[model samples]
Target: MKASLLSAAILATAIVSVTACKKDKSTPNYAKADDFMASHAIKEQSFSGNAAAGFTITGKDGTKVTFSPNAFVDGNGNVVSGNVTVTLKEVLSKKDVLFSGVMTESNGQLLESGGEILVKAQKDGADLRINPALQNDGARVEIPKAMNKKDMGLFVQDKRQQGGATGGNQPQQSPYTWNPAPYYPFGNGPNSYSFSLPSFTWVNCDRFYSDPNPKTTITALPAFQDNNQVTDLQVMLVFKNITTVITLPYDFTVQKFQSYQNSLPIGLQADLIIIGKDSDGYIQFGTQPITISANMHIDAPIHKATQAEVDAFLATI
Candidate 1:
């Protein structure tokens, strides 16, 4: 009888110990709330100076203008520069796609805004949570309030064009007086005309062209010419349809040129290659070369003849 009583007492003690340990291991509701508050705490992030200038765009004949800004508030309540691109997938269906603007720091790091901001915690390491709401046009757009980053959308304004002024500028007339000069060096003849080539300020050789459509106002650099001193030259061409800029690099070969052409659409192909000399005295390629395709709708004076024509022209140079 005494052995039975002792065994019962031992079992009761074990049960109590297990219960206490379980209670100690569980997280309390209050502690969870405190953790959440600590992680989302943000300081002053404001835009006290002039807001960045808005962009202007003209729509198609029957289309309307639409614009929006991607915004985000930092820990100090400061607004960072970023893009908010709104793609009009379908107007009739009211379907649209919105992408947050990505911002790069001076250190070359990239950050994305909008939705949930990634947050850091003392115990949890890194986490994501919804950001706070932003005021826009007398309404609020709810955003995740985490420490990561946030992006907001801005309102757009539009105006209609009228009268002869239209919304665009008028064409300007050339100031040079007409003079007949020899075109070919066949001595002086009445039919000979000395045409003045357009002049352009040489920006950075690596600068990309910025145009969605072809224009007589802008012309890409010329192609590379091979000489006996240089064995080979390679050029790289990058083209974007949305921006409509064709960037050409100085160093590219026939194979690289073919690769670039293959990557583009059937109608959007590069027209020229730009080349220069490297530090080793060998002819190097340009950093950015404009892509000119023959399929463009704009009737720009710039022309990219066939490969045979290009070779013939290079031979002359």
Candidate 2:
């Protein structure tokens, strides 16, 4: 009888010890990590995560991203702190993309739960909003608030076109299409006096010279695309169901709200149409316009393009 009792006691103690260890140990929340990887366009096929080891993933562009063992939290939101590393072997092997950051346990919980809330509410995917400054140091974007990824995708494509990527790819198909000049954002007519608002000078091409000028044609020129240079003859802002026509010399400015009788929200998007004769004498050009939000306070940088520059661009197009 004593031997049986001793065995029972040992078994009970062993059970208690095992339970304690289980309580003390925690594993990574694989689901949350997987969601993060997918949202960033990173491939999660090779993902490996656990309490005893680290987390890792490969991006679509063949970049490798890894988190230290404790970089993630468990099911209950407790952070597991470990070393974090990022490798861009195929993306930027020669360039350095190293980053470091610190996240308190509370912060991790907030971020994790925030993402969950967004995915549920949006039905569509969400974009983790990290502070722009954090993006500078190679730190992965700090997932704060989530943005509607579809809307943001449109926004980024517009930005690329405005930055002279017009010839790189066809304009993305969207219900609302507005094209800003590949050279400049704002238009300033000859001798404008509104110094507070800025205007960008752009080259307007004339593929079909009319009147006294002779039309010049390049026999060896490549096929025409939307990238041809054009001047800003007129621009109009369409938003809040109101169309505000801006003639020669207009400021894509914060004051645009006044046109709506102050009915426009601060961050609301406005579609723009720029009608001007291209170098070929064809009236063709339109683009989406960005908002004059807080980020664009005072004035945004001006982009200028010349007629010669426009011709040079056409040659390549």
Question: lDDT of each structure?
Answer: 0.24, 0.26
Candidate 2 TM-score, C-alpha based: 0.18
Among these predicted structures, which one has the highest lDDT?
A: 2
Backbone clashes in candidate 2 total: 16
Off by over 4 Å in 2: 1-48, 74-317
TM-score of each: 0.20, 0.18
Number of backbone collisions per candidate: 34, 16
**Candidate 1 residue-wise lDDT, 1-317, digit = tens:** 99999999999999999999999988422212223223423221211111123222222211112112322334444443343221111111000001111111101111121111111111112221112232221111122222112222211111212311122332221121111112312111132211111111100001112234433222233333433233233222323232112222221332122221211343343333443333334333333324444422221122212334333433321
Candidate 1 ranges beyond 4 A from true positions: 1-72, 76-132, 135-243, 246-262, 267-270, 280-317
Scored against the true structure, residue 293 in model 2 reaches a CA lDDT of 49
